[model samples]
Target: MTYRPATAAVPDLGVLTLGVEEEYLLLDPDTGENLAVADQVLTTLRGPAREQSRQEFRHSMVEMVTPVCADLTELRDNLVALRRSAAEAAAAAGARLVAIGATPIAEPHRSVPDKPRYHAMSRRYGPVAHDPAVCGCHVHVGLPDRELAVQVCNHLRVWLPVVQALTTNSPLHDGRDTGHASWRSMQLERWPSIGPTPHFESAADYDRTVDELIAAGIMLDAAMVYWYARPSAAYPTVEVRVGDVCPEVDDAVLVAALSRALVATLADDVRVGVLAPAIRDCLVSAAHWRAAHDGLDGELIDLRRGGTRPAWVLVNELFATVTPALARHGDLEYVRTQLDRLRDEGTGATRQRRILERTGDVHAVLDDLAARSRAG
Candidate 1:
């Protein structure tokens, strides 16, 4: 089905709704290898959850999206349920679930899942498609006005690196560093439709851009505009599609919380007539560089000040700036605890590296993820 843009005449966007999609790698618990078994698993999963299996291309490449959520509580509950069901479903099919950004054990020639859409992409993207080893967590925040959506997307171009730095879950690709914290980002960037988006002055402008891209044969439609952040064609939302798929559900929730808070904070500022100064393209470049290089440890360029700041420092500032918004959304405690967990423990990438370091087997990392997911 084609997508339709949301109208700007809708009421206040403050009444937030959340939708999240998590892409997972199918794994064999014993060997930690990427296994093309998602289809088998979904078939074995009985009950209402089985309905999702028929919703899209599935099995080897599984995607679970939460029902449109009215608030954070509902969103959290949906996430927990989906994760639990996925684990159960995987176990039933003699497979296991590991929610890293990309599986380290993936090989380019490892069999691709046999789905029509998968086939289409492979036919189009060729060997570049073989690296479909990556996974990601996408969070959707409602946009009350289409015009404001463009503004939010423009400002988002500057913040994506921060999210990437915080959620660098793919430190290893095909069992090597690949020199990128999130190899999925690098891999996905190869597509013609991926990258930062240009600023659109209005909803009509955005429509025009999409039309141009489609006419030029660059993409099929708005859904193909796979920027780090952009207006959603499927819903009245701005979807942030950057971060690597986080292993921990808490980490996912934290990222979603922060994203919602950031968008809402920016929207509120717009409501009150606050204008952000134009950030140079270089600052955005530096921001992405910092994220790709340092992950959590490296310094990120602060867009507002045009200076380098510790990644965690920027995270802290984000938490602080969104405190009031979090309170309003009734997610302050959840958001605070999630941030504290990252601060006290470490990011998924950090924890995975430490685990791999101790055991010297990449399988141990997968096992650890599977164990935590079960506990959650």
Candidate 2:
């Protein structure tokens, strides 16, 4: 299949169009276990007045992408509507909806969704690829040009793990502590061309990389880039694919908001000929290690200043750097509130561990995830 370009020319620096695509697991409403019934839910929600449906590799997992949102207000409303429609449809079918980076204990042996794409993935990726429990948060932000998009991606490589750190929602997998905040990140790292992408000097360079990878038989198309951050093959945006599945819809919005600010700031810098600081691969890997080991509580490696600092400190610095743009975009209050909430309440990764410890019931943890997901 031919893969179309992921970018289009946007004339001005006017507010960048932003949207988020979330993957959710379909589960039995009562038991709260993964259920291969997304087809049923899709059938029920088909011919929709609001949202549209697309196919996924697994019938148990469905993806929802909001329309292009001009600003934060529209983004919020769009996501709320999509979540409500999905929840109502799933509930009507006696199925539950859950948002997590990776389901806590999904068994790979459970029937694959019986879909052709899933079957192909199973055959190609074998066990790790066929894992029925994986889910993710994909945020798409507008780019002015393809070459600039490649530059943004090159600069974004170091900070991709930082974004992953903030949205570490999957701590438990296979009914055990996976010893990582976003275990899905660790799990997906097993795949070829996975994790942080390399620096691309221009659009031509990006195209050549993909072509070479395909010619080498490592990938079939541009869709196979599959890096934590990549030029979206389907949308005119840069899709940040590093975030774990968010346990709460609000956190999902927070992650998306921050992503927009980050991208916009980078674009401005690019326009002014100010490139992002170069952090070596060793230090970048160390930051990823810190995020996985300590979650939000861990200290991250400061790539620029070459020192260590608390993750929240880095988050605050990031916000401060982007505050001017946030104020201009009228999203400052929302971003501030979100950072405060995460700091005060902790992330889904921390919350999952706390809930399991307090209740000592895996089912209770799953139930809470589903409940929180609907609170949007």
Best by TM-score: 2
Model 2 spans with C-alpha error above 4 angstroms = 1-12, 47-51, 108-119
**C-alpha lDDT score of every prediction, in listed order:** 0.75, 0.76
Best by lDDT: 2
TM-score of each: 0.90, 0.91
Q: Give the per-residue lDDT digits (tens) of candidate 2, residues 240-324.
A: 9888878877788888888888888777666656665665766776777677666787787777777788888888888887887
How does model 2 score by TM-score?
A: 0.91
Candidate 2 worst ten-residue window by lDDT: 1-10
lDDT, residue 13, model 1: 59
Q: Rate residue 214 of model 1 by lDDT.
A: 82
**Quality of model 1 by C-alpha lDDT:** 0.75
